[model samples]
Target: MDDKDRELMDRYVYQVVRRLPKDQRDDVSMELKELIGDMAEEKGSVREALVALGDPAEFAKKYAGESRYLIGPLYIDTYWKVLKIALMCVLIAVFSITLAQGIIERYEPGLFTDLGSIIGFFTHIFSTTLSSTISSALGVFATVTIVFMVMEHYKVDLDEGKNVVWTIDDLSKKEPGSKANVTGMSAEWTPDRLTPVPGKKAMLPRGDSIADIVFSVIFGAILIFTPYILGVVWFIEDDEIGKGVMTIPIFNLDKWNLILPVFLISLLAGLTDAILRVIIGRYNLKVMVSSIVSGFIQIVCWIIALKVLPIWNPNFGNELRRFIDSEFGAMDFATYFDPVRFSNIILVLAIFGLAVEMIVTVVRTLRYGLDEGKAR
Candidate 1:
């Protein structure tokens, strides 16, 4: 063979064998090279032989099976369907809000008058859109995964009794000239009805999956990011503790250093779910376990923030009083809005929510490890 043919054959072999596991690579590479050489002899050219073998990636897939698993066999298909829908909804909602806010916030006296300003304006819009999309997608992924994890754990009958028992009599009826078509529409056996024997694949409807994913992402994002945003607002204009450029928002918690990391851990957990959803596309045993860890982290953080640590900034009270006297606001308004009382109410609600989530998650791990429910 010419040097060029040898080089081309080597490249093709490398591409295919590189995707195999390390243990299998050497054996597969030798086998593929010998097979390709034989095919090239028949095909008359190395290029033609490689083309007949088809795409390197596809050939690798045929040999390799699933190279990477985000969701396991039981959970991936549903995860994928749900994720696509959630992503679509998130994209629409995020871009709409981001575009509107970007235009409103970045408008300036000379923004449209110069080339530089126009470039900056578009850049701002693009950055905001991208960030919002990523944030929303992550939020959606976490929500879908957690919900599916719970459902998987419980072995919720996704498609209850989708398959019916078959009989030898039915098979015998399909023999030549037996014609056992039973739909009444068929000219064979005029059975009143027909039931399809469902396959093992989960029967989750795409629309339902999509809706579930969209809702989960939106709600989860709100819960995770609200505190982060508040913390950011608290530190935006002031480097000092307990001080901000604007009047301290009544909703902000004090001691950012203490609360921030806890919040980040929880957020990262949600992000883990998002990445898994994108990778695996289903709720399974592994996803459920990961979620259990994420949930526990959030519950601990919430418990501390609610029952032990102070959630509202004490500085907000001071700021409110100052604002009241400076503006037409009532002086007594600040006194009426008690941060302690406000925090207690929030604590009660948060704990209750966490308790519900914990129960469902724990129950799921106990029940379904990795069983493929009739409905994925």
Candidate 2:
């Protein structure tokens, strides 16, 4: 109601307006100031005007809706929609591959048993790894596209008020190869005299060539090999079937020959995926290096497993003896350590690693993409 109260309201409006986008911020602030002034005049009291305008926080929220970065609202909305669809498509493709593998194993067991077996082993080894790679690539692509579209939609001028427009006469005044200016040598061409061009916003890294491909491949390979190496170490430490009686399946030692090839193929596939990502987009070298280190750490785990398992249980050695004897009987250690348990453990580890890698890759890709867009 009073001049004091109107001044307080003016301060409140100014604070709220400060948070808005710079391009339109001044206009919006001026409009708000004028609106408050008129409301105060009509209501006779600033408190009455404030009550009519509703809560200050709520008023701020209303204006907040107008604030956005270079990316317009429509583009952000569409980008998310398309991204979800693309992700769903990728998921469907993976599921279809899995289902096809299952069908081949079941219905045509005799027709392609050998081929099916080989395929099945590889499918298990690299399913999670491939999924992770695909997800990361998709995330990066989405980020880049969104950024590109935003830069296109909004003609964001970083220099804004600082841009200096030079006239034709100003350029002509500087003689063809003159050492000094036309201002009687008093005007020196210092660094400050030349207005700096605005720096471009950083954009997502783009892997547009062969070098990127190679980097991705190397990174992926390490990731794939790390787990298999761990598994091998686990196998070697508990080689005597009796030690893993409670965890392994009832298959001949000969059947395990399948695992070696599976591991190798998985390693190769992982390497390929990594290479593809590097080739297609930018990624952090640190992350790839860390993954390699993780693989080595996995080997150490295997060495630990070898030493620790036997010491943990006194019955470990005796269990092997019992398993050997029971082979002649109906009950055997092989039956105790079923294929399901072994597969489950391997799958769990693979899935965990895949998840971690995917998360890191996606986050990095998005950040790089956003930065690149800002630069542009």
Candidate 3:
């Protein structure tokens, strides 16, 4: 057969296998491909071989070996997979929100001075976050399980309609004397309608997308609620009052009023990328475009916040210097180091990191677009 015929066969196999459970997809794909090859060889026409297989949905149902239960064997594996994804997402969200709230409520200047307070602070937040996460997890588990059970019990095919039953008549309909439309199945069921099988390397792991969601929420929360956490802390020796703690904030508090919106935009961009990644489930042109857009927005926002705006605390260098000199005796701090320049360096590094991420996404998508489970 020609390349076009081979492509058609692959598409037909993809249609059948993709409807099966995730763990079964690869094995079924290989089996279906081999079966098609054998059938085509016997029939002398790939198209005829596919027609003998009947509707892909019908073929998949037979191959799936479905069983009737609260959650049938046909859907149990997929139900578990969905449950895990939902639970992880809820866990990340609850933990990040809980930690952010804790930071906002408990974080103060020199709060880290005492090792005991540090331990206590973490202990309290961990306990609170754990309890919250567990509660949220239970709710997520119940919701996902119920939804899957209902779908399974009803034999609902989401790709079709709710409780859809395609009869022989549905498959037999055809225009009178129309040679091209001989079968009951619609012409739309042809291999041309099949989606390209996503390459193995191109597949976007749900865990990675979920991780992006978690990090975006966490970093955004840190930026919005506790920007002062990223700062320098020191202690002062007071002859009468004993050792006192001090802090020099890294960012200009007033400038945060302007920088925050830009940061929010970046955060939204990251979330959009992550959500798209999860939905698409693979590296493709669309996913690459999203990654680039998100990375660009983040890089631009960082540049604006770090370089164009006076986001860096104006007196960070001076205040830190005074604290250092007073505590450690006379010493040249500014001559040796500069906080503003250091922040600029960090911005440069961040930009580099973001750029690399975009490039990697593009390269991975292109490199794997054609692999298409051949190695598997």
Candidate 4:
């Protein structure tokens, strides 16, 4: 095959094998490449050869087995993986907040003497736990299912397929150190992969990178859109604040007027990066570019948090004062939650964490890209 045909074949193989199961990827890719090459040789055109194979997406389904399922075989693993993560996040956030509130507000060790009190106490506990756990789990299921459904519908590549391809050297029997020398289904099988040497465009996803993409998109969505849903659940009402539970939504959208626009732009950029990473299943130039944009946005958020964004609610200021006084008699604890100082401290932490992460990610990804970019 000429350089053009070889390049076309490489792209075609990538499209096919990336959607297949990892264990079957190498074998399928080699077989597909061989089939395509033979067709191209006979058809006298690489384009015609690919056309004969049909749409790469449809061709992938042939190897994938055309099962009539909502989520195909290719994405079941990812679906479960994402579902578990989302569920955990939701549960942890919901339960932690509610449980903390419940424990603090209703920490009565004395046995309930009256049947009415006993019934009421148990009912409250059951209601609180049931509401928090079930609601949060449902929300998570919806988010995870929606994301997976979109992926399945679009047939987004999620690294289920192997990242190997056939090379001309496979024709040579005794090529020392050649990747084709690797064995499959044998004692000599070294992962049974003939990994295509990394090139300018060859950026395979690392486990960490893919995970980062998944959680970032998931949590970012939750953070931006459903801020009200995730917060400190407060049931203990201060006499000053009046009767009823008060939720201190630290990331509340109602108060996130200015910060919302800027923060969401950053969030959206991160979400885009994550989705693109799933599609490419790698850290490439585009991914790196997105990271750079996201990093800058994170920095801006930190700055805003420090300068303008109130970490604590203004509405809660007077209530907090009364609550503190009631909980601990005659103790002035206003400075403990000085919004400016607290937010700045939080910003400091955020900036440091994001800076370190960005630096490490950029360096690792850039080195990989540079290594791939070397003249072959």
Best by TM-score: 3
| Predicted structure 3: clash tally | 2
lDDT of 3 by residue, 23-139 (tens): 999988988888888999999989999999989988988877754256876566656655765677668877878885675556655778999999988898888888988998899
Mind sharing the TM-score for model 3? 0.53
lDDT string for model 1 (211-295, tens) is 5444444444444444333321211223364332232444454465576566566555555544443333333343456556766
Instruction: Tell me which residue pairs clash in candidate 1.
Output: 70-280, 71-280, 79-281, 79-282, 80-281, 140-217, 253-311
lDDT, candidates in the order shown: 0.57, 0.44, 0.71, 0.61
Better of 1 and 2 by TM-score: 1
State the lDDT of candidate 2 residue by residue for 1-376, as single tens digits.
Answer: 4678868887777776766657867888788778878898999867777779876666766776644345555345434533553344334444444443333333322334487666765665467546765775577567657653654355333223121111111222222212223223444554434422222321223333233334334433333332222111121123454231132222222333443344444444444443333222334332344345444444344333333222122333344446556545644544353334454575567656765765666566455422321223
Q: Would you list the rank order by lDDT, best first?
A: 3, 4, 1, 2
Q: Highest lDDT: which candidate? A: 3
Instruction: Tell me the TM-score of each prediction against the true structure.
Output: 0.45, 0.29, 0.53, 0.47
Worst 10 residues of 2 by lDDT: 161-170
Candidate 4 global lDDT: 0.61
Sort the candidates on TM-score, descending order: 3, 4, 1, 2
